[model samples]
Target: MDLGIIGQAAGLFAVTNIDDILILALFFARGAGHPGSTRRIVLGQYLGFTAILAVAVAAAFGATFLPESAVPYLGLLPLALGLKAARQAWKSHRNGAGDQEDTRAEPGGGPGALEVAAVTFANGGDNIGVYVPVFATAGIGGMTAYAVVFLVLVAVWCFAGRFFATRPVVARALARWGHVLLPLVLIGIGLLILVEGGAFGL
Candidate 1:
């Protein structure tokens, strides 16, 4: 196994899925004190993420049929997404809303595993956009490595979310920094993809 490829896979997963931590934290927060809520949340997360990966993998397989020269154009997806996220963050900051906590009311009952899975899948639009191009570019071995790393990281993300449920301070910090960090990392990844792919002669 190539350590460099593993590191790249880890980095890709980290940047693309950073926003999930906040959502997971919220889910864990709401599910607290409900019987078996934790189990359901984790299971739902896995189910949803697996579905997302399946779609990405399938799409990537299709992407492989595209002209090699055109494949690099897929980098535009992440670049656009990063710019959009950055714009939103800037707007929120200008409106003095960047630091505001999520104040949405918790649902009446613990969300079932399927319900959580739905939400997770719903939130994965960006994931698909990013994953498809990356997976298409990665060969089978590299893609397998990425998949394994992603699955392992899902557990870590779940643990972090659960921990943040009990630690509002840490969660708040994540919220504050995440807005700043997410866009930067995404943009960087976008550029890396484009440059490495020699997109537009860059």
Candidate 2:
């Protein structure tokens, strides 16, 4: 089942997801004020995400359980996060913050590898759910494939997140109202999580 690896990877993926979220936020900040690069963001996405996931997978190796009970609650997090994102994007548009909104938005050109790492570390909230307890339990044999699933998932998401952030259509949509949708989806999942929390938490 590769459960062990999967558990570990899950935690790492969660953290990476959080980094991407922050990257998106910065994308807007730069677009309106500074102007970050696609390469730097992508590189950064990989950095913070890779490190966290690595540790998580390793942890899953000889442990028992990673608190699968939190899965439901974790599931809801995405929806809430997405919705909130959309709302903010919409508000930015309404306010006509304009590309030249704030000097603070000034992007630090060339998001070099180190910069990427810094950004990844800076955005950890997004991974709070699946990241922490993903493999907190016990029982596991060979977990190579399990970890791969999560590693791949997070890696892909980070790539896409950065790519999308730099896209004109995506940026415009986000500026218009994408954050709202993201958060609402999270809300729905949150409700489901609540149910899980009440019923079979495991």
Candidate 3:
């Protein structure tokens, strides 16, 4: 394994994925008391990231698995999720559930793995754009090396998110405001993705 390739892969992954830390932290905060939440979150992240990589690799090889024009529309995934979360929060507040609702077990264990994966993939539009060119230039060996490093780094990223969410002050704050902020954050990210990608010509 060439050190240069390893370094380049690490740099690319770091640049593309720095934003993921906050998103993952919010997820951990939301799922703090739930059993198996950590596993689900991590699994979802890998699933989503793997999908992104697959698409990038396919694109790099001149395979038209996903049209470039459709990339921006991926924002819809997070947008819909945000709207759903917001509606649920509003109903909970209207019903006076308040803080108690925060710890309530969701119907399917508080955000299924697929739900998390959707958000992860939605947030990765830029990752796909950046990765395609690099993957195109890298041969088989190089691509394999990059993939291994990327997967390892995903675990590190998850650990960092979990660590941040577990902090005393951060946890308290998230416990209080996570429900409110989660929807807003997801909405904001969705809009940003749409606008940045020029989705719907916005």
Clashing residue pairs for model 3: none
Q: 1-202, model 2: which lDDT tens digit per residue?
A: 5565667656655655653554544443233433556555556556755665554555445442335454344444444444555565566667775532543355664234554454343333234334435544433433345445755775666556656766787777665554454445345545655575563444
Task: Please give, for residues 10-30, the per-residue lDDT of candidate 1 as tens digits.
Answer: 898889778778667766764
Cand. 1 Cα-lDDT: 0.71
Cα deviation of 149 in candidate 3 (Å)?
0.6
Global lDDT of each model?
0.71, 0.50, 0.86
lDDT of 3: 0.86
Sorted by lDDT, highest first, which candidate order results?
Answer: 3, 1, 2
Rank candidates by TM-score, best first: 3, 1, 2
Off by over 4 Å in 3: 97-107
Q: What's the distance in Å from true for residue 51, model 1?
A: 0.5
TM-score of each: 0.61, 0.42, 0.93
